[model samples]
Target: MSRENTLLSASNGGPKQSPVRSNSSDGEKSARQRSQTPKVEFETERVELKKSIKFSGALAILLGNLGGASIFIAPTTILSLTGSPGLAVLMWCVGGLVTLSIAVSVCELALLLPRAGGPYIYTLQVFGNIPGFIILWGFVIFIGFPSWALAAYTGALYMLSLVYPDCPPPESAVKLLAAWLLVGLVALNCTYTSYVTKLQGFFTMAKASAMLIIIISALTTVTSDHTQENLKHFMDNSNTDFGRLCLSVFAGYFSYGGWQIITVLMEEVQNPVKDVPRALVSAMLIAIFLFVLTNMAFYMVLTPNEALQSDAIAMTFGRRLHASLPYLLAILVTLCCIGSVNVVVMGQPRILYAAACLGHMPRLFAMLHYKFLTPWPATFTMFLGALYMLLSGTVALLINYISLYVCIMLLVLLLALLHLRYSHPDREQPFKVPIPVLIVQVILTFALISVSVYEKPHELGFCLLILASAIPVYIVFIYWSNKPRAFVHLVDSFTDFIRKLFLLELPTTYINNHR
Candidate 1:
């Protein structure tokens, strides 16, 4: 038999079909067996991801992703929308609370399902293949890639600004740098999956340290004279721009965006049942505390106008403390963005791999590298999508596009939790969120989408276009059950070629077993 068939058969739990010729000497056959034994054993043993991420690593990932450069950059947008330091601060608080509630609800789903793909898996398990496809579809095109692009874009912009303090950097330069950052990080993820936890730990520490310095510096500068002055006009510019305000809240929540990412990696997390919840809650609380303080510090140090007009809020705030602080702040914020991109690189491809394992995607994506055990095909595919977005789209446009669908999907995932509770009451739920919290989340999420879409029909129309585009693709590739033999041959040949080229193989844990 052929090599592909032999590996496939072994992975499928069938007896190994050794290609031993009858005319071959016994000595040659024995040598072949010796060479093959270790490989077959390796493939069979490492079917699932290794549980390498401990509690600290999990916390680092959640915090690193949540406390990305958004805290440094998003304050400007929020302050602009609210037009008041106090209300802007309030918006951050509200966003954090809402996100925390969403994370709690997701915790139940993560524990119950306890697999890769995070929200994608939760939706797939409860809602079946088509709805699952929609979630995965939105994630790949809308949520996942755009997030990486935005971080890279933000990072590149800040880095360039540091280099050219006198003039704005050219757009081409920014895009080029962003592309390089994305490529390098993707390569790191593909090459060294085991090192991700270490990277996350270091990045999270740098982020926390940077935020702390800013917060302490600002607080020390605050005194009785300016304290009352800052507080007196806290609500001075607050007004009702209902639509833009919703977008501001969206921005605030965007800062807290990646809290759910660890769920996708639960399979790789050690002590997932206990550690997942701990890491999520702890990271969120710390993020909220620091984010709110950081914004407060910005307002206290600079006037509302100064805070709004400045391109880099953290840099501006840092410069007040010392002339050289902006340079340091720029470097730290750039690292924060890189860390966020790293989290995305490490987590998002697992969604594609999980989908492929379930037959929702091409089988090639499901294959793991023979030696590294990383999902190289899915990782590289995601890298290409993110690179395209980085080169093509701007920061503001990507934010609007990503936030709407993410809210919609969060709403769906919460609804799925409720559905699972009702439908599978007898199911073993290691964690249970209060129904009221879920209900409130549903209401708030729906209201956010409704108001934003209502006020901005143009953005809503564009988002709907991207969303509806998935259905036709689904019908053609996934929904259709029949295909000509030639098409089947073509697909199989392509899958085989890529598998052999990359030294990839299917995992022993197939989709049928998952269901």
Candidate 2:
């Protein structure tokens, strides 16, 4: 039946109609509706739960999830660390493919578990509640949401440069401006999630096109003596420190981190089972091409030193046309980042709403905005948190924290994949990352382990928190689940007992009436 028909049929009886549910004869419902049951029955198809994601849409989600800040920052890190252009470039290629393999594994998991929490959902399912909740909040506050807000702030500052190059907004003003950006993007998400999603897809094309144009211009450089030396540096692999190059290329590899964002949106995505794998592989391929070409262009025109120095490198790239080109680059960056900013603005709140759905947060967040059909409470709270990030100029710290958060969440997901591989041996999948991919995933797990050990010692506490939430969940399940505490249950049980007693009376007393 059509969704409209079903809703209408379900609603025809008036206010209580939605809850009337199926007849006991329907059989499908008999398992759900006994008064003492623990599970709740949703009347709607919730087919959104089953729908697969599309290719373009998946790519859009992936980019919206990861595209912004990394592209701009990685090149600087690449040259600073590797110094060998060949080694640096090679790592990016290898990293992209390895990342793609990871993406493939995530897609497999998404198909198996298409829950709203994405990685959080997968984690909770495999690892249990505590780890899931910890990972959940970690992304919501510290990393996934805030980075996008900071990127928007970066855009706004770049935009303001158009008018006042001599005096870009002061530090205080930047904070205030970032706050406003955070609020504005939140407002955009408030308008409607579906609209924001469409906007993200649209903006991805624009970001890609603008980047392509700029990179093309850079690659087609007019050589001066200054440019020649930088060109020679890239081609001359002999003097490049190979060890440093391996470590140095991390910048570019890290830049590619967001491609796995598909894992986050697996639930809302239409036909995710079919679309996710395709979208992930495609986004990685496109991002790989873009990364190489953009870097080539960045190096072709400017030397390594110039790239490291410029906060707004595109401005310098534009200067090739005229001194006024920085203004245009500023405008482009501002607009594109706004698009990316909106993506995060829209993405993170779903995690919160998922929290509510799973009984962590208050249920109000689970309510769809009556008009917008988005999670109004969750989106609003996310905006407020982003505002906090903006005011504190804590973007730097937030980035550090969030990077750790993402790493932990990823580890959870990798483990989740392994769980599914063993747990559901009978299930057939349309797509599987080849066995070699599993080996790569094991290595990625080690990378995450190394990062955690070598870098963030504090993350273990968060994972411990994950373990912590489980205790309360267990307690709640034991204490309250089967026997709900409320006058409603009292009235309900009393009503059932009274009705049964009256039914016995009917058989005896109605004997006279029947005669």
Candidate 3:
């Protein structure tokens, strides 16, 4: 096919080909047509995602993911690693600013290609099949959903804390709760996009309120308490170890990680050109303010050793302020984790759907529900992946693996941004980031990955092993055209069954004018 025709096919839905008719008797033809009627009906029905998300919804999606349990939990890790209250807070500010730069640069790409897949789509368009497939496989399949699994697990643990206040919850109970949360949220997402979007706004507000409560509580105790002593010598006993500092900064970076997901839902936003940039910048600023103040509150309310020793930093901070406050904070933190899972289920499937539409993944993933116009198949795919990770009991290792994997993904994406700029200078880009900002982002990413490896060299091997696993899957399922007939037919039958079961149909792709 010509480039124009290929683009046309994708925009229409998928690759379009002429149907072949056989020279069979009328009775035989009728029998075959009757047997294939459902498949024909499934292919004929098409739809698009509703453009219902405005600035508030867009900000909610970004904040919902950005202000996850990480903020409440990671401060202790950052403080412990840096061993200095001031240095730890500085790391948070630095991570926020660096991440802001990356977000704006991604805004440029989002504007250039206003699509659903975000980086996956950009990498596919800028690079080629193998690179794109690697991103979809390694990032979404390996890193994305597994991170959600970790969130669900954390949420479950916090939730169970309310029930078992004196001790911990059973491992089996935590797993069961996490699984139920995943199942319930996926159902919500598959039912209505607006339902999940509205939930994001509500949960984000709850998270912000929890932080504000902590900040205000700290301020009220200022005159009576000696918490200020912790920050008196801000840089005292600061760790100078390069590896540990890198780990600390990366922890801070993880708290600011979810802003990039905003670009993935450009197609669903009401006004992508204006609202996307507005929401991205505004959400980052708000998140940074909340995180910095909340950390200051932690150090102000509790001693450094107290803050470092506590397993749940926010819960401990609440308990120090009031006997009953820890219970309230636990509920809020659990909601934050649930909100993270909500946004993950909301956005990540779109990446899979986009890849499937491009023939990089199974076509079933490209299908949308007839009634809801949502990507049920892809969402279910994420649920299954997360379920596997949850049951395997390797979530902690996956979390570590994901941190490194995310840095590598971001570095490659930044390089892809540079490649697009010089290689396609003539292409229209409305929101251009400064050259220095891009340089800083690249340098910071490289430093993090390098130091992380220096600290734990074996992690690099595990990360590589996970990433390299994608290559063989791609070569077998996607790269090779001559798949076995029976195997292909079995896959097709399975896909057809899923489509019928969920009442799913292909969705039309929106190709922006610039691309």
Candidate 4:
């Protein structure tokens, strides 16, 4: 057949082109046809996270996260450093203001890019991949695991206190209890997210009620038994120095640390642009009220020296109410620790998942449970890390290592807001933090870093060392290994093993798309 005839026949589906064609024109025509064909691009399937969390659930998370065991522990540290309830209260208020300012900046970022990983997403999007990876590494190693471990540890200690009020429990028993608590919470979160949210809601209400009862009883029933000498020294500023006051502020800031966790679950929130920011502000306001009032309640019954002397200030306050009240207070403190631990476990895995999706980490961390619609692998990974930390008994060391990095992360996030302002000037920001608020936050973050470094140089150095350690990891996993296909394949096999072992059904859509 002639070349033109052959092309016409093929167009009409009459006959296929024969392989025996000899004309040079046919070869050129075939090349032209191939060049004109459009490319077919395949998109990787996305794992859909369940949006079962609502405003109330998110508020509960925020409340639970902010009212960690730190509140019970930090008051004594603040009081010891400040030496006056009045100054400590002022520091609390000031710390809340500083944190709220930073939260406002985070709110703006969360609204702009409402995804998982919270500050990691913000820093990643604004800065770039390396900086983002650093943040993620810091979170996994420093922020998430250590915080969860500490909460579990504190909860275990408080639970033991109920049984052994006179003497401390053995280290082995405490470690075992902490390990069980950490594992149980992780399993709950991995199995079902709805139950986790509901549990958080219940704990939030229970703890808030307990706190309100303490506040009311102290204000109404306590006979203002604070000594005249304590009152005379209420405004005492004799021991106050810049560094000491800064340390008190740091303690208060640590208590107020978890408010920004709302951003970590932005994807699961029903209304990210609206509810997340609202929850952030409302939760912080509620936390500040409870913190100040709880501290005031302590001062109402105990002198400054008495408050400073006790290891557990909340128990001291409760003991003054009634000798038997301390036991009840211990239970409340345990609940607070559990709630905080739950929040940490639930939120931190999302950071790993986010990083994995972005190719900053192994793909296994990004896999969601086929049935539960949760990041099971990431959650399990975090659980293992937390368990290791609990076993090692380095909770305090991990916390100190993360503290400076936390400050640096906050500073970077604020600077990220400023950077995004100019770089993506037209991006939609449903909740815009005023320039003054951002500026104030940046200044405050710098001051906090400077003060922290000046006050605790060794701690700052250790944290910096921990952060710097991420460089080698990033080089190996991302920069040098080039394509991580082997790693990804291994991860997928492990995920499949987990699914089969757990007897969970794979998602129909994922199966279809993969096939």
Candidate 5:
């Protein structure tokens, strides 16, 4: 068997679903039905994706989340949060370590499952469909789309900042333009999904390289002129408590959120069980180092006050250094941003495809372009969703609601890990989350609580409310479509209670090696 087929056979828990013919009474899924989602009958060509590409270490971490905006803005904001160059880098180091803990946890779950939909797939198989669906849609519309919009908007504004640093533009127009750009991004996603990894690789390399240059330049040229000598004295729980700072860093951290978008397409990855961890860890390290180094560089060049007030922090350094460099940095930043945008454009549609495969959505989404071997319809739909978000003006507040979904997905993934630990004890998976891993998960959960507890109350409330809204959507669209009132009628609402309480586990199949 070919490697691709072997990977598919192993990755897919069962045979692909196909349209059933009434005459053929064979007890099996049909190939035709398995080929496409039943909902949309758009023409598709199956094109196989390349799986040989490999990314190592921090690049993998960077691959998951670091996008256009982080390089442009995160360093300055982090520094401003500290109000001191020395302390800002320190916080980045600390935050990177903390974020890695979560990455490690995600890696643990991802390797074991090695499927698409990342946290959503893990959760659905473990907890059940309800929780999984919530996380899945939460990511699809809320977290994933909004983040892309925010990134795109940030990229555009960053681009604008290059030409007109003095223009005090209102936030409203920025969002509408972002929304239009989101439509463009969605259209870009219609191109192809498989090749996007390479694009991201290039983006990752370019962004890191340019930032590194800036860092080196800053370090070489930085004198005590800009460094606040007594700024460290003010680093305390005064401006915002330690807890709030940590949680709000979620805003900062969102910049690095897309690295795992790769895992959402685990089925397409070559040797995912092995590669995924390597990618996650490597990406995290690179992002961590770059984040720390970049912050230090920014401090060397711009004071915390300067960094915070200016959106074009990198550009600030470039403008002071040379005439062409700011635009040059913007060029690289735009490419990096575009690359990240392409990466998301590649990822979310597959999650939608996964949902379709699970029968939670129309099956046409599962269809692959015969020519491209990619899920075109699913990809396009996600592109549209992202466009809508881009059109929305609440980029800053909007993304947090998205993060809440991302967090919920993480929560569900933990439950998935908990479930798989028991349900398929002897599965052929090579990786396992050890007992100590669980201990770390508990600690991470506590940390999330600490962050969420003392974090901005208003943002927290909004996220919760949005999450709550998914319950009805799930019932109306997914549940009603699958089986209306099936749960409530079956067990006098006990079934409903179990589903809500335990989450509905809807694995791809119970069969083994059936693909």
Candidate 6:
């Protein structure tokens, strides 16, 4: 006390020694430090995904993603659920609008972040690490891997259908072909990024043209009286089953899925903020028109009962034109499936690479082919997962699992958008979805989730169980361990050997500098 008094006396010029001012200065300094932490982390951890995708490339990816085998299979399902051609058509329109609205919201977020992980990156940035990790896990397991497997399986099935028009192929044969297809696609993607995008562009153009020709030819040519009778019952919803109608909308929405593929490649696009939104909107518009017209063409050719009865609606529609047309359509459907598989193979690995760079997974996944700059390790992981699905012969079950998770993830994404608006108000937003539109998106998202839960509670529960399994993974790999483990090191060595064997280029610097 005597020493303190003497020190105070030495500063007697400020006899009022204000503790309040000193405390306030300390608080300000601490606040500044806290604010700068995230800024520093963001600067240090900024991962750079190659910006090679141009406007045309982006558009091609979007179109390729939207025009998958869904177009060939989903129309009949929608018609079956609605029990009326008119309502089914209306459901497609409504589904498109809902998808477009969600896309608009996603476009806003993509502009803000413009990163590689799509919703994973968005949710992580807006909410935090755990939420992002959860979404990433769900995406890789549910959407990405299952989609690749399903496409490959369906493509193989269609290929076999062409080989054996009268009889179905053996399940073992289908599985083998599907596994081979998955491998081939993975190899193509690992070779060169530009080549893959070009392939996608070509596929999009060819498929769109083929669909247009089919639509126009079908609409122009008159069908039998039975087909006309189907059209006459277009409005007859005597059953008026609301649950079935909701399921029809769900099917339509499923067909309208994959529009978010553009967002996942945000960092790859040349002008992500401008081009991504344009590509998304334009692709969805084209898809909506094509889907509705194709359904109209289906009604033009076959009765509702016939459409419901047929396993392959597109082939049936084509058969109406000519006897040989069904085979051609089957081949076309196979091509569509291949294109879809290729698109997923191209896009999904980046999410894994992005996760790895963020320290959510092994850093080996973050490795890029030095010359091609493709994420080969991540691509290989996806290939392995798809191959497992093919071998397990659970393509349908995997698809059902994916559907529930898709709805859940979309809901998470929409919530992320809203949270970003409130939490990151000052963040640069080159494009912003209006609040009202976001609200509508929220409503639609909830409705979709509700339908999924109500219609398939057991499936949803199973998905939740699978998602819960990620908790232990997160606890061990991400939370408990900061350093790479033995298996991770083994994977790294294997990747290195592959690189040397394949004559792939080596990194010029520490690849994980961003980490």
Best by lDDT: 1
Provide the global lDDT of candidate 1 against the true structure: 0.82
Worst 10 residues of 5 by lDDT: 38-47
Ranking by lDDT: 1, 3, 4, 6, 2, 5
In the range 5-88, model 3's lDDT, one tens digit per residue, is 233334455544444377665686677646655544344334677787899999988888884687676567788888888888
Please report the TM-score between candidate 5 and the true structure. Answer: 0.76
Per-residue alpha-carbon lDDT of candidate 6 for residues 292-355, written as tens digits (9 for 90 to 100):
8888888777777778887777777777778887787777778778888988998888888778
Every candidate's CA RMSD: 3.8, 10.1, 6.1, 8.9, 9.3, 13.2
| Candidate number that wins on lDDT, 1 or 4 | 1
Off by over 4 Å in 4: 1-47, 221-229, 237-240, 482-515
lDDT of 6: 0.76
Q: Model 2, residue 276: displacement in angstroms?
A: 1.9
Model 5: per-residue Cα lDDT at residue 493: 58
Q: Rate the local accuracy (lDDT) of all candidates.
A: 0.82, 0.62, 0.81, 0.76, 0.61, 0.76
The TM-score obtained by model 2 is 0.77
- Which regions of candidate 5 fall more than 4 Å away from where they truly are? 1-53, 56-64, 80-83, 161-189, 227-245, 248-252, 422-428, 481-515
Winning candidate number (TM-score): 1
Error of 4 at 166 (Å): 1.9
RMSD (CA, Å), candidate 5 to true, equals 9.3
State the lDDT of candidate 2 residue by residue for 210-254, as single tens digits: 677777676556466655676677756433554454343334335
> Model 4: per-residue lDDT, tens digit, 85-130?
8888888888887778788787887787788788888888888878
Q: Residues 400-475, candidate 1, lDDT per residue (tens digit)?
A: 6777888888999999999988888888766788888788889988888888787777887888787788788888
Q: Lowest-scoring 10 consecutive residues by lDDT in candidate 4?
A: 38-47
lDDT of 5 by residue, 337-442 (tens): 6666666766667787777667676545554543345666676666666666566555555754655555556655665676676777777665565767666665
Residue pairs in collision within model 1: none
Task: Name the weakest run of 10 consecutive residues (lDDT summed) in model 2.
Answer: 502-511
Clashing pairs in 2: 51-271, 52-270, 52-271, 52-272, 53-270, 53-271, 53-272, 130-466, 131-466
Candidate 2 yields a Cα-based lDDT of 0.62
Q: What TM-score quantifies how close candidate 6 is to the native fold?
A: 0.85
